[model samples]
Target chain A: MPGKTFEEQVRQELIGLRLEPSQQVWETLAVQLQQKHKRRRIFWLLMLMLCLLGASGWWWIQHNTDLAPGHAWTTHADNSTATKTTTTTTTPILPERIQPDTTPSTVISQTTTIPAHQNRDKNDYAGTADQLPVKLLNRQAPRTNASVNQSGRYTLPVGNHQKSALSKDLQREAVPENGVIKDQKSQPIPAQDNRIKQSVTAAPAFRDTVVISEDSKKSVVSAVLRLPPSDTTATEKNTRSADTAALPVPTHQPVDSTKASVTPATQSAGKSGWSWAVQVLGGLGGTRKSIGSLFAAPDPLRAYNPIGSGSPGSGAGSGGTATGAIPVVRDGASLGFEVAMEKKIGPKQRHLLGLSAGYHFYTTQLKVGARTAGTLLFNNFNVSNQTGYYFASRDSLNYTNYYHFLEAAVQYYIPFSFLKANMRWHTSLGINYLLTSNGLHYDYSGNAAYLFQNNSLFNRLQLNTGSGLDMQLGRKKPVWAGLQVDYMLGNLSKQALSDQHLFRISAILRIPLQKPARK
Target chain B: MQDEKKLVKDCLKQHPAAQKQLYELFAREMLGICYRYTKSMHDAEEVLQQGFIKVFQYLHQYRSDGELGAWIRRIMVNTAINYLKRRPQYQLDLSFEDAHLHPVDNHQPDLRVQMKDLLNLVRQLPAGYQTIFNLHAVEGYSHVEIAKMMGISEGTSRSQYARARGLLISWLENHGINDKKDYYAR
Candidate 1:
């Protein structure tokens, strides 16, 4: 009734305002947010990767203590179980896949004129009487035999006994028959492969015997042998070259000869057959717990608006305006590094699933509202009670104030990937459970310490270091041999500050490691 | 097709397109409130921009409560008031002269014409009378509320509204648009 006429008139005027609607200002805001996320992504990712790497290394080096080699002895010495023996032997050999030995060949002759017990052995295969120089190539057991004691750091004597008729001479300085052995007798007669295979009948024929000298304890095997390419491996090599191809069938092969061979690995593996690689990641980024940053908003004016209150747990004040930039913790730039190992299981599909373990050292920090070394703001931590948000407490970490956090987490990993020439588009997702924490730390009146002495908060917070969507993935065609890129996501909670969530982008290089070959 | 002006831009650039989005989101509500506080559309639009720029500049300050549009409208109203104080407008004279006659009845005037047309009639009043009319009739502000807002006396606000309403009624009559109920009776 009062301003009805005024209101009507105003409506017509309202429609007459600027016809060209604009929102340039908000566009800028969106752009700023995107850029911020991208940059922060690089640093936090580094920290997370480092954390993983460090954790894995620590766990591995600690539990993998049995890597040191042990003694070896004859596992196959049963002269009592003699049965009808044959004089002929046949081998199903794929010659097309066999490459010739390029290493210097030694010609040692072994003439064992033992009392030929008239072919008296049941396990013996029927063989032709072509009395050529019979030389037993090494016979290895399958990986299962030494799985219980397979030292990730040391090679052991599992099985290696394969006899073959050859034109070359047989020389046996000393054959280690059992585990790791330093003292043993030397029997220089060409032995049969069946003897070694039978000794470790329970395992796949790839676990080679770690032969030790009868006098010297040094192992004669210098490196892990490379086996002839398997059908699966051959296809995988091709697919790996195709830039965009399918999973490589498992190509692991058993060595055919001791001189030039690829030793088959004897460790129990996850779905992805390859043993987990320990990767150490290190970098520098923003620290979410800058003292100046924690106190940036200065919760002033506790006026009652009936909306809500900003106390400890009842409600969290929007700590401070996000627009305000935080200062640096150190001058040059904060550096953080972590070590983690990932053991891929499951065949090489577009995505690989596995259980990996690692250690991490991630120290990220950003100056909270820049103050010089000798300045009053940096020198003093006397937080004036601008807002009565805290109960009687002297420490700032107890309340949500100036602080820093150091935490470690164990995670399970899943990786998806695509390859471009020389680059790999990789996406890794993982869930990390915090195992230990050096709670929020800060320079409180120059007394830097952890925020909490114990964990009372009941919430599950995952810190995803640098796992995310990768834009540039593969390097070689389908995939070159060794280059990779990994991204990580790091965060503690939903209401976490931007810096609290770590996102990192990294270039990875993996070297195909070789095991000590059989002599 | 979407307006070329409303194209999305890099938010960091503070591009025109971003501003256009902000404007599109709050324009209607902001205008409705702005018009109630200002004397004219020109004043209202200026106040709208002034308010929008502040909202955008401090956009990052907005946290979880999602309804940013509503929050911005309140700012538009305040901006309109601040604008008037910064650049005051001259008030229209309320001295009633020749046709000042006694009221015939206590009943209110009736109208059957379009709301837009009736509003146009009220717009014909000077700036001072327009503001008081809008504050009382549309915003439901008391004379005291209007006075406090414009830095004027309650008496002045009441007088301005009375004058503005009289002129609107006369304007409607001159248009040969007599009160519908009364004309039906005749």
Candidate 2:
């Protein structure tokens, strides 16, 4: 047989070669694989949590946006009417009232009885007439007359525009009209027309009585008004009219009514008012290497040194001494409490400017050490003239720092709808002024005692930026809960003992003291 | 074969016992493969561990059509190449001097030189030469495949394999070992 080639022989010899690995390799591999699996599991769990939070936030936002537009419309209309009524009453003889009625003859005849009541309360009549144009009022007048004729039970016109304003007045008279008009229907058509005219003229007096009722009842009226116009029933109208008549009418009410003027401002404030919130935050903070420490001399005491010169307790030292001390700082926990107020800006009330004052406490432990060596010559000349010694000392210093911070920030809220709740992404940038710091404890051992001072050791200013999700809570949802993380820029340490980059996470509850009324 | 497919599926699910069984079945041969590309047994074992981890991590991507052993071997080879690339000392240069040629005598060969001895001889070659020789000769990768794997030209891979073979043959001959295996036995 021919001899195998070099390559062929080598391939043949090594092709099936196998070498066993030691048992330790398998153990290490198993541990690594288990750790990888654990890490993967943890990553997925966090992803799931994040997805849930996002989904809840989305749901909250959707609920709020869906109701906002309707609520805003009612509040604006009520506020504008209230203001218009007050202005019209104060200036009863305005030139606008003198302008010849340019309306059509049909509208003039329908509204001829309004001028007689207008002389009694100019503001109320003008407000009602101005809001209800001739076209709209005429359409509802025919309906009211037709409903009364058909039902003989004295059904009232449930016009959409007048429903909110007159529902309370009409509700008191509805029950009486139902009983009285049924009996009178057999008497005379002329008598029924006279009664209708009399009831229409008495509306202003009933409105005065409704105004004197509890302010809380006005919200009920506004809510009822929000219902679909077709759903208003004769019984509902009678209940409202009964409620109105039960109250005593005011003889001469003030032109600027408290409920009308105050309610609108309160409602508007609900939408764009100044709001305050208090937050308590706690987190762990780490100190980076200080710039001063980087440039400072290396600690000489780090290495072992033989005793050379002076006795440690001796009062006097003669020879040149070499000492090195380094200050080492460790990470610690931080606690903070803040009270902040925010005001809505812009037409959409999506921008907020806020100012906050807070107090923060940080506790840190520092280790300071020094190694020193020197030769001491004693004046007493008793034994040896030169005493050589080396001594090293380490001391732990605990510091609790209290800082007062004043911060101002501008926030933008991005509103999005998810399911039911109102949610907004609130992002902000702010500057923090360290108003004061206290409880800086300085303690050291041996030659390192001079490094720290109780005062002038920390920078008093920093800038921070953060973002979080704000979710509306409760039925009215006047309260909001926010989760935020703030990163403070710049160093905290003045002398480079530690760098002052701070990270803080906080859960915040915002209560609206006042909000701009949605219009 | 069905058992192997099930074992592979279990390993993909990260079943520890199945992973260990898979490791036990192939680790020894894979270690030998790693040893040829690396300079030391420790490095070979490290490569073997890392390659097995990667195999478990990416096992789901493995198709059922091919043999599991071949797939694992491919991963080990790629891992060894990567390990060489990561080392600061492993430079890809073809400036090595040609091995001195010695005349071969026709004689009865000694079969006593174990496979471990041949492995040791291969391990003694330069990192670049050892990698190319292992890929082409033992792993049966063509020069073109070796070049792509090592990020080098095909001509460079061929020349380095030749140098590596010449050097290994010279060492065996110097040690008085004969190549008596039949060339056409397969």
Candidate 3:
């Protein structure tokens, strides 16, 4: 073991150096917290609407998967029960059949085989101008039943259904695995009289068939496909037969809109999974005098010298005046909001965490001992005793409203590793780093006079609470309402009853949304 | 409070809990290792964090046949040495000798000190000698292993190891604790 002698002692020293930021930032953070609550409500409401829209879209997709032959498909096989038949022939390719998906994937089998050494010419991979005129031949339009040489790359658009018909003929013409080409059906279709589907754009997709199961009463055929490379010419693509025996190759080219038949893509995209939610926190921390402590009313000291018309009601008679040698306690209350982002981890199970930073934005009225500001000879001594000093702290003389705050946080979602049932709970422990806060100085017009701030030492405790209901939407999605609270252990000064630390609360709502994963 | 099997399992998963545990358990020892390799405390921390992060990322790759903490400690020492390797200039100018502690005569015994005192003396040695002395005397790695680890010849490692031990013993003898037991003698 190393550093054995110094580890504990050094760690203790380092721990003492932690940064506790200032509390003057509470005003900005307080306002931001309030805005956050409003935004969260709006967010959840929008999330709900988005979820409804996405769910409707997903339902529409799940139920509307078309099995028609001309509907298009790009890697579209996953527990799908659609019947697909692909034909290979030289006719102009279908123009409106391919809807290109932007996701990148490695399609293993979409390759053109070349003789080992003929590829010796670097140009073989990208052939020379004389070797293959893809530009000229491709412009010649598309043809069906066009025979490509066994070893040579085909440059023109091989008509769609013709590829299917030609494969049928190829079973008779060429022997299996032998690389032998029979000479029939080798003629290309003419440019002017092309009656095939117009394939203006071609995606490098190869469709292959594997027989899943076969019975006299039930026949199951599957076409496993991948998105073709975007560069390959339409004619160079081939349609191969599932078996050489005797099944007809159906000419199936799905329409453009049919490309996104992947179920998870549709399922993930049905609804917004997190909903917008909000919570409000309010507290009235007050002080009371026991009846036993102040049972009798005492005589008034000539506390107010009222020689003028204002002399009568200027005594110690406010809304709350506890009479006793016992300490007087002033009560105050604070309001705040909490907003959050939530994600579901399991079926009917959701884990959510929220951050809410706020404090009371209270208006202050300062009083000096029996004297008002800008006083001369008491404006003729009669009303001199009737006056009380009313001055905001020099620090807050211009804008005298006090606000509070806390901000920026990160949460650890612990429920992601397990499959919990109906329990939408997540407990996270993190530091609520407070931003810089402001103290408003009040002028006679009540504008901000100036601001000086420091981090409240007592603001460094855990603000812990839970909000949001665990809602189960549809069959799988989970929705949770958001609620949260914060507790700081510090308090303010003497004449005021509370400490420097603060507490806050808020709520949230989660809605399910869609994620388009595959097409 | 470390569990024998469960600790290994949790470490393998790179759980943050396991990381905190590893830190609490070995930070002291690793810091000693680091102090032997580096000139300053801050540098030692940098090396420690680097080594610990590597140990965590590769925890799953641990084959369960060996002691888990030992395996991680080896990684830490290597990481510390690697920091020296990248800055060859650190080794190039490593010529600092104390001129004041020579020609000591009598012996004063400090019987209150034990293994901890000797370890502190090892830490106060210069980086090169401290690392070699600790590896050979405490860690029990062979000269060949030390050579491969520090990217130096075995003879240099041998000579350095001998010199480190001689310096430690000489320091103790000068401190007046002459047991003549070759007590500081590795």
Candidate 4:
């Protein structure tokens, strides 16, 4: 309705005016909306991936803990039992796998020269023999008093009592040359060895005793001796003599030597052998909290219409122009650092599992208020009475939460040729246990402190999944440099202001504790 | 009324045909509102596209308490204000001497001139005057509300609106539009 006056008519005309927009505007809006939809889809897809990774990681840890190491040890124990029953004399010869540089004379002098009848069926002796570096079925040794079996195979003779005496004398002479046996009196005789010698008389060796000597006096004498199962008296006498002569060498030295010799053999088995790595990672992180009804839109005006309302001069009051609340989040940049140890799994070293502890610090500022209606607007808290409030302040509450977590991760590597360098793509899944949390420190402005004082909200744990490109730093070094993008699953808060996620991009350096020797 | 509600529901579900329909229904009036705040037709079109995008984005926030057109109008006005604040040239200030300058009125109103002519005259005014006039006169926002929206004092808003009105009246009268014509006849 146009008024009589020119001004009123002008106002009426302008209020009702509608100018057509260009056709291209709709197409542009459509394309823009499509892109937004695509972005939202990508975000959800990433979230799904993180969830799957976490679930799979939890399953993997549960499945492998009891199976891998237990199976390997069982098989090794069975093999040791078979080897003990087939051989009569416990000659501690170094295994062929061990390096030749390790002195066999030291091992022989350390071994108890007890005859088989007194020390036979002793589990500790069998275990010690099993651990010895002695080579089984060595074809290189000289044959003396060889026995021909029905299968046409020549068996090495079990040395008689006289050979056993000669072997014992050689061992007694060689014991003085082993300077590594520094503490003779401190070495305690194994209880099993003492029990057998007390029950049975010494039996002179009914088995074979072969003595091999080097030209130099300093050179080690390797003696391969076996005791007969039949002569209990001779075995007891031999056990007593062997125990007296070998009592000077500490039992632990042999074990240490065995481990030192076994290390290279285990290393060559595969990359799957346990090699520890320490990683130092630093990254930037961002956090967001969705505080549901804590920030809601202001109530709309009742029974007010802009089109039906009178002219601008009529002073239609503040009826239809209600101020709405806008949620404003100021996410501060975060700094995070972690130290972790990783172990390779499987024969090909395709998977690396790690346990890491890290500290992450984040600060965020949150504010909810109206833009227009200054301070005179009613406080939404007192909805019943509609208490009038003023000064809609821009002040915000700052929350800083620092947390430390221990995380277990499993990663798979896909190696590819990149720029003539060995580069690998690593995908990992991890679960974090929040060890401790420095509770939310609320720094509120004015009235907000009183409003949010009792809010108890924090995250106890989270799941993380990441992928990165790792490049070997050098051929000689077991160090790797990588660029990683890690996505954490779960809310930062358990109750109020939940639904927060953390994403971190970091450059990582991994250094192996024992560097693999270069080929 | 039922058709409008159903169209909104379908648009919320991202039905393409419904989105096009809603756009066609509101694009014209929203464009007019944007045109009043921007400098050129091109700028107005840009603002209109962005404003419509926001409408669809926050459509779920719209309660059935008010008219859908009014809700969309509020969003478009806010979008225009945001667009002006982002551009350095369109920042509102009262210290400029031209804001204090009064255009001389020599002739009576030209009623024969169409609404487009009046919009052209409004666009010719300075950015500050144009925004305050649109918010106060056409959009029916009070001086207090306009002051808060533009981050200026209520006094500044009243003065700016007054200057804008004077300039528009002068421009219309100069074009020889007679006030004696039947105002209701288009």
Score each candidate by Cα lDDT. 0.34, 0.48, 0.36, 0.47
What alpha-carbon RMSD in Å does predicted model 3 have with respect to the real structure? 26.8
Tell me each candidate's i-RMS in Å. 8.7, 6.2, 14.0, 5.2
Worst 10 residues of 4 chain A by lDDT: A67-76
Q: Scoring only the second chain, what is candidate 3's TM-score?
A: 0.70
Give the TM-score ranking, best first.
2, 4, 3, 1
Q: Model 3: residues >4 Å from true position, as ranges?
A: A1-519, B87-89, B93-117, B174-186
By summed lDDT, the worst window of 10 consecutive residues in model 4 chain B runs over B177-186
Model 2 segments beyond 4 Å from truth? A66-519, B92-114, B173-186
User: What CAPRI-style quality would you assign to candidate 4?
Assistant: acceptable
List candidate 1 segments past 4 Å from native: A1-10, A13-338, A341-381, A384-519, B1-186
TM-score of chain B of each: 0.61, 0.81, 0.70, 0.81
List TM-scores for all candidates, in order.
0.27, 0.44, 0.27, 0.40
Chain A only TM-scores, each candidate in turn: 0.30, 0.38, 0.27, 0.35
Q: Using alpha carbons, what is the TM-score of model 3? A: 0.27
Model 1 lDDT tens row, B65-170? 4456545754665566566555434332433322333332222445455544544455556767766676676556787887787777777777777777777666
lDDT per residue for candidate 1 within A1-519, as digits (tens), equals 333443454444443432322243233334433444554675688668656755654454433311111111122222222111111111111111111233332221222211112332322222313221112211121111111111211122221222221101112323335422121122222223323211111111222222211112221221112122222343333323321121112222321232111111112222334433333333332323222243233121111101133222222222322121111233112322233333433453223332334443333322121111221111123332222211211110111121132334333333322331122233344454544433222212222111111222212345443332212211110111222222234333222222343332233332112222222
Candidate 3 residue-wise lDDT, B1-186, digit = tens: 237467767766545565566556666666656655665554565566567656655777777777776787788778887776655554763343333333322232332334545545666676677776666656667878987887677767776766666666566656743343332221
| Model 1 whole-model lDDT (C-alpha atoms) | 0.34
Better of 2 and 4 by DockQ: 2
